[model samples]
Target: MEFSRRAFLAGTSALAAPLLLAKCGFVGGGGGSSSDDADTLTFTTWGTDAELAGFRAAIAAFGEANPGQTVELNAVPYEQMFTNIDAQLQAGNPPDLFRVPYYTFGAYAGQGQLLDLGPYLSADTQDRFTPAAWAAVQNEGSPFGLPHHTDTSAVLYNRDLLTSAGITTVPETAEEAWTWEELTGVAQQLRSALPADRYPFAYNWQGNGVTRWLSLLFQADGAFLDTDQRTPLIDSDAGRAAVEFSSSFFSNGFVPANNTTTSASYASEAWFGGTAAMVWSGAFQIPDAETTADFEWGATFAPRNVRGGSDFGGNALVATAQTAKPELAAAFLEFVTERDLMADFCRSASLLPTRADLQGDALTFDVRPELAPVFAGQAATVEPEDAAQVASPFMSGIIPVLQDQLDQAFLGSQDAAAAVTAMAAGIADATR
Candidate 1:
């Protein structure tokens, strides 16, 4: 979930790296034997320069706090990170700890490849994180990992474009966020004012980001799966409404024709390149847009429907079942999620914090401090139930289903109902 400006924009256009699941023939194996020097541990993660530096600072602080404890850090590219971890895990020699997205954490935990931290972490540790964040790292009621940080999508707009379109007033708070009908009307106005080559807005659903579309479904008070996480609930009224609304972005020419979920050009490119007036994006893009954008820009809350909602976008820090130092690994996990450490990391990296104490107006960013509250507002809208569904072990399989079906819907190859039906069937199979 930590991305520098350049990496974040590039990632939006590329297909997400394929998850290395058990189906890929990675057989189970035990971790390294207990080490005599338990104080020394190895950790791995992928991050931008700023994020890596923040992590290094945190590790140094941990070393200071606990004498003789050392954490060797291994930095890798995001695309190759999981594949490497899977290889090491299969070899029974994985790092003591590694960073994982909430969606991917389930696959490892479900397979018993991750340590169950419930035994090591204090019971009060649960209260440190937001309910949604705590739920993201849990599997079957046990804490398999800890959500280190989180990010959420908001509306990043070009100031001049809105003024040219005669739209001056914008939502200042999440409670005042634009409704679906209001957003559609805004898009309509922007569309009339924009040139043939430009668009009113673009959605950040390209590639594996297809998961982001769930925010709209959630806003409509719809669940992709029932409470059991085994049944599809995406063929109902909420599903249809969410799909129809998003599909209108394409059919009604509100967004660029090439901005479909499968497109090579992503929403960030359109917004920054001046082809669109506004872009649905996350705070991770703030730094990049702040430096490179030629026009005036700012952020606002994402559109709401029956309720407000946003994508729970971020990664968690987890210990491997194969670590030789379980207690030390758990300690490191606890240290990183501490209020001060998490806040510092989030501020430096242009990401959101997961700690309950640091959310909303509690922590300010080093970059674009004023815009921090907008993303905080978006994060506040993420329901714990929505987070739980997104953090499912089946997400690796479900992502492709969403990409294909949603792409078909946006491309006019399928209608909203048809897409919803296809997604339901695919999800049922994936969960099965």
Candidate 2:
């Protein structure tokens, strides 16, 4: 993969913004227990203000219930999670009960850094949450992590802008969302009516471009990568189609031409200021968008592919193998994941708590109901089960290669097929 000869003005904030990655782990221990069997614990997690607040609310009861135990929150920048985790592990000190992203689960579990909670989970416990929501930690044959929640995007649109462009109709179902051809027609229409300085749509991260670049990947269809993890699934025809579809915006002119330097703040500001009519981002961004938009705005499921798809990202709670307080940590985990507490947790964070009951009807026509389409699309779309696995900060460093090389396709330098070929080579190179 080749990078455009350029510099990005956006400050590198250690994106923990989310990317697929390898894995890393950490450990944490609280004060020793009065008894040998007692284990003290500490925890860590990542997210924006609303998410953190919601999590705090969920754990409040747990804290009160176990006043005698020590529970600490370790807030680390999402981007540096893996790096910080490694440094701590090397230093012989780490948080005892920390969160792990889906991507890192394999690495952490493979390294024995994260204590497997499989033996601890009973069939009754397993049935408490939706199987789909647990996509993060469910590997080949065993479950390595406990899913707490999930994240997916919706198209945040400017109602006024749509009306101005005479595109007043709103989609009520995924099928109603625009088709790629139809989307391009709108982009052309929007450009003709709007100022040249304005863009029709804006999105964060690089993969959305990839998603647009291709229609789908063969590996995803049936040959899903075997346990070996060295498969050429993404380079298939369907994969290339999906890759090109995502990149078409830059290649086709719906998105800004000079996109490498386009930062998250730029897109958010554009969406709010009306310079951009639509923004693609996870449901959690509602609070951010709400605080900034002037006119009416709302979310809808993203446009469909041959099949509808959306990226999934989320967190998992796990106890470390050497935790001095497993019982206390386990209690904390159980408390936060309880159905009663989970809704409050999801509401505060604007997260779709993984608990089966909390993931469904609990979100409609209430508590920022505009986000319902995002979750609905997630549950219905035929998406890769391992979405969170791609969000690990551990493999973040490698994504840039894939990002830059495919950026060419986005810029129309190469076709989607070539771009993905470059991506496969890049992933192999990075892993080696």
Candidate 3:
């Protein structure tokens, strides 16, 4: 919960990359309207069945509390949500409210495409959220969105597979989680025991998820960008160690070769298909895994380097600046984040809550409640500084750099040192 009061950027240029506006031509208000009634607000999002149900329930409750308000839910596939939002934003008719991942929130907020909640929300509202969650929604020291809920990655393993590989004991607590060397040994043991076609594990770094790889860098005490959020800091000794250590997962045959950043297969898919003994995945996968897997599976902490770290894997709810009813939209956001409502959504969706008050034994996960402690413990390792860096407005620009550079390193097209150099250079270009 270590929070920083200093602004993330020193100038407007670093606040958000100009490339987004150029690519999308989001110049604000154009013409169309979703509805004639100012009381009805259109909400766009991509979510699982449970997640959508939670939203519908919250919207129903909001409608009951406020007589004239209505929230129409427009749910789409995850792949198409952003594309549709961008088109709507460019046409100046975006939904009043939309769901956005924390990493992608900065792009919208930076371009001034989002409504600032400071004017609509209470002064003490910031105190309601965890420091790391609040940090993710801030830009230029102001709140642009609300941290609805959060999730983090952990190691999900097939119990029968691990037992077959001569592995019995697993880290039950975050503090007892395996170190990098210990994990390597476990992978080596699995590799020796399993068939050649089968692999030890699969990493969830496909597509835009390349940002999750930063857990290793942060664990090694390296920062992608310095405290200013502009300078590149990924060319140091810690950077090299992270690069070399992660690349070893590929070289040592610990994870599948197709587990590179740009691979078509996801880590969970690999685990489901019995191609991997373990998979590094987020807590959101629990409900599906619990129902889908034939074998008994369990989750453990992600391996630690010098310290434990994990990806901040959840989305935020933001109201568009183009909304006709800003006050009503802000009210909905606040209502959804209330203690009881947030806890219900998290319980239903198997996600972690961002509210500081909900992080306790009082809020039990409905699905796989026994594994909740491991994920909660792993999520606690994400310091406020780590969340702040990931939430930088430049992440949209930096994602491609991480995707391309890390893929090369994993493919052995570039050495660790060269990859670190290219990454630093790419990050420099991205922030500028």
Q: Estimated TM-score per prediction?
A: 0.91, 0.80, 0.92
Whole-structure CA lDDT of model 2: 0.58
* Candidate 3 backbone collisions, by pair: none
Between candidates 2 and 3, the one scoring higher on lDDT is 3
Top candidate (lDDT): 1
Worst 10 residues of 1 by lDDT: 19-28
> How do all the candidates rank in terms of TM-score, highest first?
3, 1, 2
**Candidate 1: residue 173 lDDT (0-100):** 98
Q: How displaced is residue 361 in candidate 3, in Å?
A: 1.8
For model 1, residues 1-432, the per-residue Cα lDDT tens digits are 111323322322222122222111112223463234556778899998889999999999988887777788999999999999999888877888899988788889888999888777755677788978877877766788989999889999999999999999899999999999999999999999999899999999988788899999999988886544447888888888998899899999999998888888888999999999999998988889889999999999999999999999899999988777666777788888889989989998889998889977797888899999999999999987787777778888889999888878988999999999999999999999
Which residues of candidate 3, in runs, are more than 4 Å off? 1-34
Query: For model 3, what is the error of residue 325's alpha carbon versus the real structure, in angstroms, after optimal superposition?
Result: 1.9
Worst 10 residues of 2 by lDDT: 4-13
Q: Count of backbone clashes for each model?
A: 1, 38, 0
Error of 2 at 2 (Å): 28
Model 2 TM-score, 2 decimals: 0.80
